[model samples]
Target: MSDESEALFDKADTLDEIRDKANKNSNLEMKLRNCIKDSMSKVDSLLTRNDTTQAQLTRHNELVSFMKTYCHERAYSFQIKKCQDVSCNICTPIRLPQTVFDSLHFLPDPVPALDNPDHYTSFQAVYGKQTSEEFRPSLQLNQANAEPAPKSVFASGKIRDYIMCCDCGKWHYVYSDKALSQDEIQDFKQSLYTYDYSCGAPLFPDNHYLAELLFVCVKISCDTPMEILYYSSQKSENSDICYHCGTDSDFIDPPVKMVIGPKRPRFCGPTP
Candidate 1:
């Protein structure tokens, strides 16, 4: 995440003020940029109550610069890179914030927005700004016996164990540890991915508990021979149909893992 974005989240009140003013001026793009720009400036004053680090300060300027250039240099909407039917055409999987695709509304074909990018920060737009997948949290699982660290920005809790696929380079979270109850376990299970969405939570007294647990793909290797694989979901559909294949596969609790990840990777957990 950009330092400005990280620092700005807590300054909600300040963001609102600037956003209100920009909207009043009838400049929605300016409103968003003002919100983001004003958001970064107010973060320390309203939320941190202290100054940001020099490094962070530098990054804050960078995001502002990017925002400015986005409005100045390029058009908001554009073509998205996706799989093509053309045999020789490349179908590199480009995952952006759902918002990017959602804002434009999934059209008959994926076309770049005729609108401005500043108006919306789709999961794609925000995340796509990142340099590589390494910036993302890894789906690594430690030994079942090991204690978990703190969760990620959106999700929290001690992750006891997880699985990493060497072939496919996919990560799966496993919470079968003693720390998680049947309910908590179910919660994490149901919320495999789709963090921004509200309805995806593993519920209690789940009879067809298997009905939950969505498939979240971290990376779709074009090689077609990925070493590892895991599934996640954004909704609670009864069918566990594979994204690649429509066939419903039996949902495994521990996940039918033939491999593992690096040693004792830490996640959000109790303060040791």
Candidate 2:
């Protein structure tokens, strides 16, 4: 038997021990057990065959790989790692927070509010004035004068703008405009990336579409980065500016066709 097949058999043994003790449903346990048996039989048949071709060996490798993955995923569902699909010019797989993966089924589509100027206006009214000092905790340990990190100015469940870091090409977050709660911010302050007002822990479960607000491609690129006030709920006049490159349609030096971004994904999780 191949090394991979042997490793898979070891995994099967582990699963057998886990299956008996697991609090999982009996039906799922039976399904997993049967799957393991079927996979083992396939492996044994291949190993004992008198004339196993290269093609058969290749297929055996694939089968063993699949079985290993299946056993792990089914046996230890909570430990499954998050995966992402690449969807933009950046050509990098943006690893989403586990929060996003957990909420993919329940998150609503991006409300088309691009036309309502007030949506952007109101957003600015609330969060635009927040300063870095406000995000910091009290430096002095004194009990009486110590102040807490600022509470989020933006209300929960609000979608705002996307933040791109010009200094580091590492930004891919779709700013949901949802500020982390005071407690969350406090917790985040201790993390390595918490030097500024960045999220320390993985962004707790939020809508993935909130991350999709800024993944558009615009025809024109502008020198000044203007905030595009888009009210995603509006059906007409969705394009006041480029969500991708921050180009104002009105200020196009030479009038060009308005930026019509390709259909953005409505939900999060996988790109498709």
Candidate 3:
């Protein structure tokens, strides 16, 4: 018998014992009978590996109901396991370009925020700390005659450039304003196409939260480079676990913006 069929048989046998111990007209007996009649027959006639039969689907639903009753009444518990089976296809193991991975260099690790755990405070977070705390009676007196402060150069907005390492599947950006020329752009597109990409640094630095966990891209070894909206935030020394892959990584600052490329791709392995 199939593993699924054998499992159902075992469940049925267990339910039978429960049925015998209960009143003949009990709900337990009714539930078990319904499971066997509606679900088990489908499991018995299973014909293929991938496709699930309607009877098998019914069996699953019944087993869930049966278990719910068992757990609630008997105070027992069960856990659902995620499947991690691999496909037998020729395609997979998409590798990233070596140059992109090589280009990744270490940025100084950020200091952790004292209050908000997920954020790292930079120099800007502390720049005004000491000066702002001083009690300046003269400054307060001159405030009425003070002209509006001029806009800081740092506040003048400018777009940034980014590149995704096809191997790691992570996007990286140039902190400077040097744009890639048409030839360089074309060259990057051609060379990285079809190369394998596995996210190497799952805990790498990010602007806010790591962009890998927030963004999803499926560029084969051949597609043209794509643009994406990325949210960068202030990062800290502490890391947040990815909700999807469960990898530990840092978060970046608050503002989200468009980025052109990938950082080292965060590895998202098969989940169990």
Question: How does candidate 1 score on lDDT?
Answer: 0.35
Which portions of model 2 miss their true places by more than 4 Å?
1-162, 168-180, 185-272
C-alpha lDDT score of every prediction, in listed order: 0.35, 0.35, 0.36
Residue 25 miss distance in model 2 (angstroms): 55
- Tens-place lDDT digits, model 1, residues 145-238: 2222222311213234343333333334333224655785566555444232211222222454422332222223323322122222222222
Clashes of 2: 10
Minimum summed lDDT over a 10-residue window in model 3 is located at 150-159
Backbone clashes, each candidate = 30, 10, 47
The deviation in Å at residue 244 for candidate 3 is 5.9
The TM-score values for the models, in the order shown, are 0.18, 0.17, 0.17
Kindly list the per-residue Cα lDDT of model 3 for residues 1-272, writing each as its tens digit: 34643454465456565556444535544555565555444433432343366565456654444344322221132332212225512123425565554443322224556787566567565542432312234444566444222212111122233345554344433222234567654544453453333333212234422222222222212222222223232322213332233344553321223231233222233322
Candidate of highest TM-score: 1
User: Model 2 lDDT vs. the true structure?
Assistant: 0.35
In model 3, what is the error at residue 261, expressed in angstroms? 19
Give the candidate number with the greatest lDDT: 3
Q: Which is superior by TM-score, 1 or 2?
A: 1
